[model samples]
Target: MEYFSILCILSLSVVTFSETCPKLNVTEPLLFGDKNSNTSYDEDEIISFSCVEERRLVGEQYAVCINGEFYVSQVPDCQEKCVHAECAKRIDGYCNEGGECVCRPGYALFNGSCIDKKSVKTVISLATKWIPDYDHNSSNDFKVLQADICASFDDVFEIFNYTLRCYVSFKKSNQVTIANVINDFTAESIEGPSDVEKAINGAIQLGHTVPGMRYNVTEDTKANSTYLKECDENSDICDDHYGTCNDIGKGNYKCSCIHGTYQSENIKVDGTDCSVAPIKVGLTVGLGIVCGIAVACFIPAYLWFIISPAFGKAEYNTAAAAEVGSTEDEDEDDEEERDHKDDLKRDLEEDEELDKQLIFHQTMIQNMSNFNPMPRVNRDSQSYGVPNSIELSTANSMDNFNHQQSN
Candidate 1:
């Protein structure tokens, strides 16, 4: 019997190595991804997988199964429950009796059983009144906030709905009055979430107002959240507020800042948030000083149009004196020119008389020297014969003197 058992073992071993290797079977793969990744199965999602513990690894440490053996390529697999899905590196939660994987941090045990914060939510409600006018003729049921958060709505609303009203207001972040339409106007605005909240806000802002209304929020009950709806991923308000936003109906969320505040912290920081930064108003006197200085700077403009032109009057007076001196000089030059013309006329008349006297002296010398009449002779024709030397000398002297005078 011992020999038969050894022979059977030998046969099984031979068959296992006979031109073949042992076949490998995978018990479904478990995947691991980065904690901060929002990729479920998007193009950017990088996931890696491996077989669970106590299972023979058919591939490498970050390996993924493509066809037969798991390959080592990065893949997407939040559906495969891996140890990386555990909350805060917690080593718990696995595939339970059902086929779906489990996650950590008290997550619901279905599908991939881990809570992704991106998939999480925080629900709030119309604390005092989210609307501008929430109390007109409106009669929608507004449940009261319970004293204890752990109590049921069915149990607490029966006792507290009557005492749950708050003064509605739209106050700015700087605590200034943006809008105040109280009275019956309040009752006209509170409707279901499906109505026009954005349109109402738009109209209010067109008149230079904000939609930040004040309200006294109370828990309907502690056992359950006030709103069971979810917010849309397209909504940045919920993310920007860190999920401390409004879950309108199913998947739409509105970023709800506290009554007297705006978003500075995330959603995790809630009620019991005490203290505030003191409000500041700029100094009006300092502004007045600046404006006063501005007006003072412009004072020189008055001088530019009025007083500065008076300084140029001295230069104008000097120019007027120079113009008067020039006129007097011009008049004196005209008088000198007229006096010289009169002297020239007198000289011309004297020269004309001297020429007539020289001609008479020449005639007398000619007659005495040639054909002598006793004292004077009328000689119209050329009747002068040869003149004596003495007579010719006298006539020549007269002619030379007359030429010198004419010149």
Candidate 2:
């Protein structure tokens, strides 16, 4: 009896284990079959898998229980689905399960398409000296005020949907109110501040007003609200080399180009990019002008001071040479004149010496003529009357002296 009882107990345990299967573990957004409330399934049972709204099911849709285990060939998945085919064709975006179109960062949905937020024209207005009739401190009252402001814009612009992206209040002298008005359908049609002002006045005419406030479209405040979305989404949008991003207002930014840089031509679409002017071209033009001026000045200066003076000096030297003769010939003539003067001086001295000698000779001849000469006596005087040798000698001497004096 004890052995039979143990055998029965073991058989009951085996049957219980074989009849049950573990529960499936699925993490995706899904809808289950009729037996979804049960934690586990019986043997040979089947469960169906389906995706929730805006999600499409992938892989196997059903799992079957074989023995004590669930058998599935491929795991099921629920992926996001786009219900509207236009969402895929419009831009690089997707439609969420809630049927809302989602665009990439820095982009916003406008006119059923995604576009850069900067390109969307927006208008901002300030209500000065505002005093609301209701309590402004209550959150509910504030929300109602925002809704009323948005409604006013919708009525004025004749747009069914107007989005208010910004609202701010200052706590000075009866509160100041500033609001951003945007209409996706008519954003591109807004011309300028005139259009904005007209719309604001129209809204005021339609009984959208504070107790003692006046609406004025502030053109300078356009940057404060229009670009806030893009700036907040990406603070580092400006390129580092070209410029810096500046937060002009709360959640608003503007890119300021650095010195020596300028806003690029695509500033409408790419506000953060800047470019430098062509420095090479400017430098070349400047150098060319300077060189041209230098050459112009140098040409006149060379002709006036250098070439003119050189020609004048050459002409003067040539005339002087013609008047005075060549330097070497003049020197030779001066030396020859000096030699002629020396020869004349020598001749005068020789003539003076000759005159002195002639005077001495004449004196000697006169003395000789004044002297009486006795005739020579000869021992043989009684001889013949013919002239003796001594007389002839004296006579020859006298004749020679007289001839010399006369000559």
Candidate 3:
């Protein structure tokens, strides 16, 4: 009985230890291993998850079965690996590994939308029909028409509250077509249809025609309808030096003249005939004014250069003559002053001589007054006769003295 009881306990323990985890319910993630084939995973069993092409797996890449449950830290998710946000909204488009938007087979990107090649060809044909002058052989014209129609359609559709869609061929095929068209156009130099050229000329001549049918068509179309001519290396229509032949459109050409050259007025000669451009009246007047001003300034400068030295010399001579005159006048004044001083000295000398003579005369008179008639009385009796001689001699001396004094 104890053995049976031990066996039952052992069986219960075995049943309890044998646990399993349920199948994962995550979307977009692919599970790998035998556990995926089964409804439940055994204890300690490992499972891995992965994502499809162009998608990245987010969260845990592996899960472990433990204690009747999967020990997954996080649920796995597959996200689209796209670089451009526009790819999300584009129809039939996906981002490649290089992070560029790619369209499906037979589809191309146009106006931010993926369109089929068939639709693109249809749009091209429609545009050609609408534009009667459209050159089917020219890829450039085709491309221009395509763009115009697409833009017009987009505008019309938007006015009605509708989304605009455009068509474009596969990039490689479109590029090849363009290359072939260019080669063909270069190889052939034949003119376009005469009927079409006539129509173009007629439209140009009328002057009053539909507006905005083609870009710059009215302005580009001349009376001669040169657009119908083909220009190439062999073409001699344009002047070799003054003009250059350029392709305008519709297998036609025109001459572009160099600066200072323009098309000749002769109607018989086309744009190829160039002549020297006439000078403008404004330019001529401006040149004349400039020249006149220059001459006016130059004459004054020349005269100043020629006459200035003469004026300077004349001024120097005048200053020198004035200096000489002043010096002569100063010399004359000095000589006069010396002469006046000599005359004054002579007058003073004369006065001094006269004073000395007067002093001598006064001394003589004083001496005569001091002399006494001393012996006059004593001699009067004794020598009356002799006295008379003495008296006569004294009188004579006195008379001589008086005459000398008066003189």
Candidate 4:
């Protein structure tokens, strides 16, 4: 009986001692000291917690095991040790120990941004169209020259909105040789219209060359119709509000929208109205919504209060106002003011025209004053033999007239 009682007491003690602890739950970066096994903890045991690397622990660093459970302080947290800096916005750049932003080499700081100049790229059209005017005798040589010249132009003018045309002629120096050398060359673009020969020489100097005697050439510009100054002056033709006139050629123009704006299908080359596509769509939808609401809410009220009252008062006020017409007692000052405005507008226009005419007259007078009809003769070099009697007499009479005027 005593053995049975001892066994029962031991069983009760084992049951009381084997209490399982609550699961260990810790926020990010904070970890328990014995994280690998956390199923249970013994009563009255000390549980240690710590922060991971680059992190600082907040609140209590140790937890207590009470009643076979870990009582974790809610205030405990693992905060990052390093404070974030504004320079961190640049992903490729880093904040130094002194909190200053630094970028790698070959980069420059602009407006608080680090931009790699070597990695920057620009978009341009490098497509080339080559036109060759070659002699029939050296067709093969002309083809080679055409390819070389086209490549040169592509390299030079890829950055510009310009077209290039090369006029090259090849002549056979020797009948035995199949290859024909360059006889003449010329290249020109919009920027330099009258310097085609010079441009051709420059291109040849840049390693694109054909062996031949160079020819004297006149400068020529490629045909382009994109924008016209005349088109800009006429608002009816090309209004700036819709878009600016881009000269296409032969007094024709197309509307080019401003930066960050686009035109809808309603836009036309000659039309004055240009509607922004997104803005037009937004306005149309907004107007439709507003109209729908107005119809739903205001139509009945308009019919009852406005139309009904207008019908009742129309006859009485209409006849009285028509009979009254206009009165002489009405203020003449308003009319005078309107007339003054019209006069001022006319005067301003006249003044502008007068200013232009004055500038033109001054330019003409200055040009005329610089005119010299005499041939440039070097008086210091030599004098011809004395003139005959008639010339001497004329010189004496001219001298006497000049002396009299001075006196």
Checking candidate 2 for backbone clashes, the offending pairs are none
- Lowest summed lDDT across 10 adjacent residues in model 1 is found at 386-395
Higher-lDDT candidate of 1 and 3:
3
**Clashes per candidate (backbone, < 3 Å):** 18, 0, 1, 8
Number of the predicted model whose lDDT against the real structure is largest: 2
Model 4 Cα lDDT, one tens digit per residue, 43-126? 534556678887755433444453344432222434443233433464244332223334322232332344432111111111
Candidate 3 lDDT over residue span 130-246, tens digit each: 332232412434343333333333332232232212312211222122111110111122233333234334543443221212222223333221222224422223544465666
Candidate 1 regions with alpha-carbon error over 4 angstroms: 1-280, 283-287, 323-407
Rank the candidate models, highest lDDT first: 2, 3, 4, 1
TM-score of each: 0.18, 0.27, 0.22, 0.18
Instruction: Itemize residue pairs with steric clashes in candidate 4.
Output: 225-247, 225-248, 225-249, 226-246, 226-247, 226-248, 227-246, 227-247
Number of the top candidate by TM-score? 2
TM-score, candidate number 3: 0.22
In angstroms, the error of model 1 at 91 is: 25
lDDT of each: 0.27, 0.42, 0.38, 0.35
Model 2, CA-based lDDT: 0.42
- lDDT for position 260 in model 3: 57
